[model samples]
Target: MKYLLDTNVCVDYLSGRYPAVTRRLQAAAPDDLRVSSVAVAELRYGAEKSVHKQRNHERLDVFLREVACVDFDRDAASAYGRIRAALEAKGAVVGPYDLQIAGHAVSLGLVLVTGNVREFRRAKRLKVENWRRG
Candidate 1:
């Protein structure tokens, strides 16, 4: 099964602060892992907003070459609208970025690997695992 990695999980892997995350990722076949367009944008946003000398951006570029970024297509948009509306009706609104990531994961039938479990739980039919826990 393909796994959709959320922004925080991507950050931790890149940061090398968690060997468990890295090991888990390494264990997966490269084709089984993917990052969403939303995550790619977030990574770029974080890199550009940082005061460092483009270190993160350079690393992300290299990383991008290794894994494909799933596009936020029509299916993802439909899922996003449904999820956002449901969450709003339930009074459990989440950030747009997180919603986009979750929507894409759900639409593509990918299990979402994220640290933001609380917020992701707001979306129905979205499978989430917190690699940060291990």
Candidate 2:
């Protein structure tokens, strides 16, 4: 199954904080792994603000080389609109970037690999898996 990795999962994989997440990523086919453009933006923002900016940027570059980056296009926009409205109606809205990532994954029918299951589970029909759970 194709997987869209959330920013927190990427961070865990990159920093080696979660060995199980890293092992799962290593075991999966590189072609099956994807990152939303919104997640990439979040990664870049984190890297830009880090004390080890150059190192973090290099790490992100290497990670991006192995995983595909999917843009948040028109389809994702439509999904975002529906998801946002639904979550709002339920008073369970997630953060903007998280919403965008969820929308992108849902639009492409890809499973979302995240650490924030409770937050992501708020989006209707979003397939979420917590890689941190191993």
Candidate 3:
């Protein structure tokens, strides 16, 4: 199955928080793994502000080389708006970046791989697969 790694999952992988998950991600087929452009932006934001900025930046660069970057197209943008509106109508508020990632995943029909399942759960209309789930 095609899996879109979320920002948190990418962070965990790079930080070595979950070795099993990290290995799983590393061993994933190239065609089955991807990262949203939104996630890349988030990594850059964190890396820029981190105390170990150089290390983080280097890691991010390497990570980018390993996973396919999914860009936000017009369809993804429209999907983001629809997802945001639908979640808001349901009284569930999600972060702007998260919504964009969700939109990209949904638009591309990819299964979202995330550690922050609770945050993603807020978007009832978005299909997500928690990497933490066994």
Tens digit per residue, CA lDDT, model 2, 59-122: 9999999999998999999999899999899888589889999999999999999999999988
Which residue pairs show collisions in model 1?
none
| Worst-scoring 10-residue span by lDDT in model 3 | 125-134
TM-score-superior candidate, 2 or 3? 2
- TM-scores of the candidates are 0.95, 0.98, 0.93
- Give the candidate number with the greatest TM-score: 2
True-vs-predicted CA distance for residue 67, candidate 1, Å: 1.5
TM for candidate 2 is 0.98
Per-residue lDDT of model 3, residues 60-124, tens digit only: 99988888898888988998999899989988878999999998888888888898777887764
lDDT at residue 37 of model 3 (Cα atoms): 90
Report the Cα lDDT for candidate 1: 0.90
* Best-performing candidate as measured by lDDT: 2
| lDDT computed for candidate 3 | 0.87
lDDT of 3 at 123: 67
Once fitted onto the true fold, the runs of candidate 1 whose alpha carbons sit more than 4 angstroms away are none
Cα lDDT tens digits, model 1, 7-115, are 9999989999788888888888989999999999999989999887389889999888877888999999999899999999999869998998889999999999987
